[model samples]
Target: MRKFLCTCLLFLLLSVPLDAQELDIFGYFEPQFNLIYLDDNYYQLQSNKLRVDLKSNLGENLEFGANFDWIVYHGKREWNYWNFIPERVTSRYSSARMWRYRFTFDDRSFLDNAYLRFSFPSFDLMVGKQQISLGTGYAWNPTDIFNVKDLSDPTYEQPGHNAIRVDWPLRAGFSLLALYSPESDWESSGKLLRLKGRWQHFDFSITGTETEWGVTDYEYPFVNLFTSHKRRLLGGDFAGELLGLGVWGETAYNFVGDFEDFWELLIGGDYTFDSELYLMLEFYHHSLAKSDYRDYGLNDWLRFFYQEQKSLTRDQVYCLIQYPLTDLLKIGGSTLLSLSDGSIALVPTVLYSFHENIEFTLIGNINIGKEGKAYGSSQGHSLLLRSLVYF
Candidate 1:
């Protein structure tokens, strides 16, 4: 199997030029240093990551793209310390690392406008390993959050998916989308099928997912909702600007079994003070269901869910302010307060552009919460710096 895969890759590479195609390469590198301070001690860590994407565009509506990522970590590790330490009495420090790579096929490799579409005027199709974001909020996707890896400990690393999708454009500014996935490891082993539609400023979706919850597997159905509008409702210099707001909400129910359900709601908006400055705020509430598979059986799936248990009801309020220091420099910061547990967190970021294609960014995050709390961990603060060159 490995030999056959290598042969196919070799053929593709060799035939690129012969096929009269355009080859484009793009990627970014991020190397970070972190200093995490707990109540008693401080942990220092360093890590490096590299990602590259190559695209071969064959004219006449055919294209292929591949992506490769490498991540390495060194120094003492914290956060989720239990995963690294088996013994309670042992104070061992460890190094962590992982890597992933994927490839995708699509009609066009970049800048997809309605005008460029020809093959299927009313329909669009995308397949293979790709990234999908399904909602307006930064982190709420009850129906499709393919790239959300960790919830308790949030990271900048986005989640990706391997799936097939079909999109149909309806009349009068309306469209419909359908997605299917044979496998998803992040959602505790699940096969998913979803359908969604958008009209004007409103969006709705429904998904049916079957996964192993415990010794007894079950299927869950979820519904997602999103609405947004950018219209002027007030007077003054902000008259022509957007005065209306946006909102998103979702709720889920379990089918083929009796269990608790989950739901989430978010409302927020962005207002521009001027071209170079803006402010935004959002409020979120999540009600997660509790599982009882462990009480029924001692199965591996049940045990895994128990060990990875999460909270049931939480509230988050956040605010962000951004400013452009110059034509090439920009800075922004955000603060999040957890209402249920009364925890606070902060993230600060800065970006500098050297030219049209070269840019640098520095970002950092810190969580201040009580020990044994949802956000508490051995790793207190983390930082990352990145450089990108686009072509």
Candidate 2:
């Protein structure tokens, strides 16, 4: 059904006799391989992905854009016997549930972005599925509710949200933005309002959001289930240049029904040298995080895995250093350190552009910690190789 719809859309676009400047098409293809080693065992996986993007000018003040992605995967699909356990705790008494993991190589296709925009003299309106990314933090975006960040690949593109969005420019450097995402009921729907502006050399935004967030909550002795809860969020972010470094911070306070209220904060700064070396450091804090490793429980793990919680530990630090070895090659390394438990995750990356239209990346993840910590040695380390070709 999806493939047929995509084919028909392509045929319709091709059948149209519009000016070349009226329509634009672009996309990329990626092939990837992954290997993981843990507890003296190794697992391998492979995937191929294709993305197609389309943009067109329907008429004056009207435009349309869409992105389609199709991906296929193969290899090992399940792993049992690994779990998060704190020090001095046995598996039977562990607070966190044992892992139930799988990597399935199924063919998946989706429309990541499909939206229509109407521009007026005073405001702009957008409708349909579209990317709604917010916040200034790179590794962690505490103020963004529509998406979750993968710690290992923080900058990857995220899925879109179905919403109606409006942007109203208030002044030369200020604007008001609103978004509404309908759900089955009014209470469950997502709504947001933001005021953004620039002052001197800094840009800032204040936002308010209300919605029902789906999450995994514990249901008694060893049982965990998915559920939804209402939450109201008030947040703000600011980015500016301080001295020669780029600095940014994002903070959010959540009021959740039937859950503890807490705060999330992230601060980071980056600098690039004349020699092309770049360096960044960031700090993240979660008020709801467990201060002691032993205080971590099954509920914590469940919520973290389900995207309700940002971190199981109270504090973390991230550092990134990257340099271009040549015009075609770049190397970088990043470290995520858990200040609450002294665990660390090291990620080293290499990128090479073999051709103007083709690029390859090699990434490695190594965890160092005692058993039961966030980045524990038992959590399994992995390496990934991926190639991207652009049309």
Candidate 3:
């Protein structure tokens, strides 16, 4: 893996443009190390990542781009340690040395995002793999309907999908957006058909989605319907250094036919003291109306729920603070607290930008109690450091 990565890097360097006007190459790399101290023992972990992006102009209204990612992992001396299991072991065995590799390539590959637009008064049409994000939370999307991240494990990362979206501008402050993603054989895949419109200060949307389970031998089809509304309150804009006061809220509900019903709500805002200091508060509620244990052949939903329930209620709270000392250095921290179970955790991070294409970060997460404890006592802590360079 190391030899292959070195060869790829050398080829990329040799392919660069000699002059300044033909093509553009941009990329970054991140390497990280982590250590955990628990029960009078210590464990170490290391990871390296590299990313590359290339772009060139084709002709009028046409362009080409490609992206690639390489990831490698190393650690203490042990075999088959990469198959991480949840809840069974809190720490790795001290003498396990492991190595793993992963590679990703995106040319916009199969069907590139090609489009042509004509300027005629006040309306336009766009056809391609455009980017769109809805909702106002770190990770909540009833209306998103497509491409939901799998956050259950830290090792798994999710990527976006290709879709066709359109934008139309009407008279006054009103506009409309519509999008669709045809089904394809991609990771975490889903199909979406949605419509959204904005009038004055309020925005409204309605969407329908079709999803197929990604797991093998247990796949099933399901449908979802979603709706959302958003409006600014008591301020001209919801962000920036404006009096430390503004309110924004959104609600989303999903109907999955005979499966299970899920819903989430988010309302929060931030206040900036100066250009370098800020504070943010948010409240989130998520709930499942019914369990679908029968579909998966589970004996009882509450039995499985009891074994997995870690919070007192279905609601959670998050508080965060950010401070910047210089253009190249910054620090931030946040706390996640479960309102129902009273379990809490803290995360602090520091970031340093060494150059335009190189950077490093150090982060720490501390849990303040036992695995299923009611308060802050039997917890564990982990520390991580990461570095990256782009070319």
Clashes of each: 1, 3, 22
Q: How far out, in Å, is residue 76 in model 1?
A: 2.5
Per-model TM-score on C-alpha atoms: 0.66, 0.90, 0.63
Task: Give the number of colliding residue pairs in candidate 2.
Answer: 3
RMSD of each: 11.1, 3.7, 10.4
Q: Please write out the lDDT profile of model 1 over residues 1-391, one tens digit for every residue.
A: 2244346545655765765767678776666666656545666767666667777654455456666676677676424433311122122222221011111221123321111111366676655555665545543444433433233223354534555567777775445656654443534434554455554556655555555343222111121122211111110000012336434555444332334344555566677675758777766665542222111221222222333212322666667777999988999877776666565667787889988877887777777644323333422666656666555
Clashing pairs in 2: 73-105, 77-103, 95-298
lDDT of 2: 0.83
Q: How far off is model 2, as Cα RMSD?
A: 3.7
Task: Summarize candidate 3's per-residue lDDT along 87-147 as a digit string, tens digits.
Answer: 2232322222222211222223222222323233555443334345654444334344443
Order of candidate numbers by lDDT, starting with the best: 2, 1, 3
Off by over 4 Å in 2: 1-21, 79-90, 93-105, 218-223
CA shift at 39, candidate 2, in angstroms? 1.8
Model 1: residues with Cα > 4 Å off, grouped in runs? 1-17, 77-80, 83-122, 149-159, 184-242, 246-259, 289-313, 375-379, 389-391
The Cα local distance difference test for each model comes to 0.49, 0.83, 0.47
lDDT accuracy of residue 31 in candidate 1: 63
* lDDT tens digits by residue: candidate 2, 289-347: 98777777756765675577888889999999999999999999899999999989999
Show the colliding residue pairs in model 1: 147-159
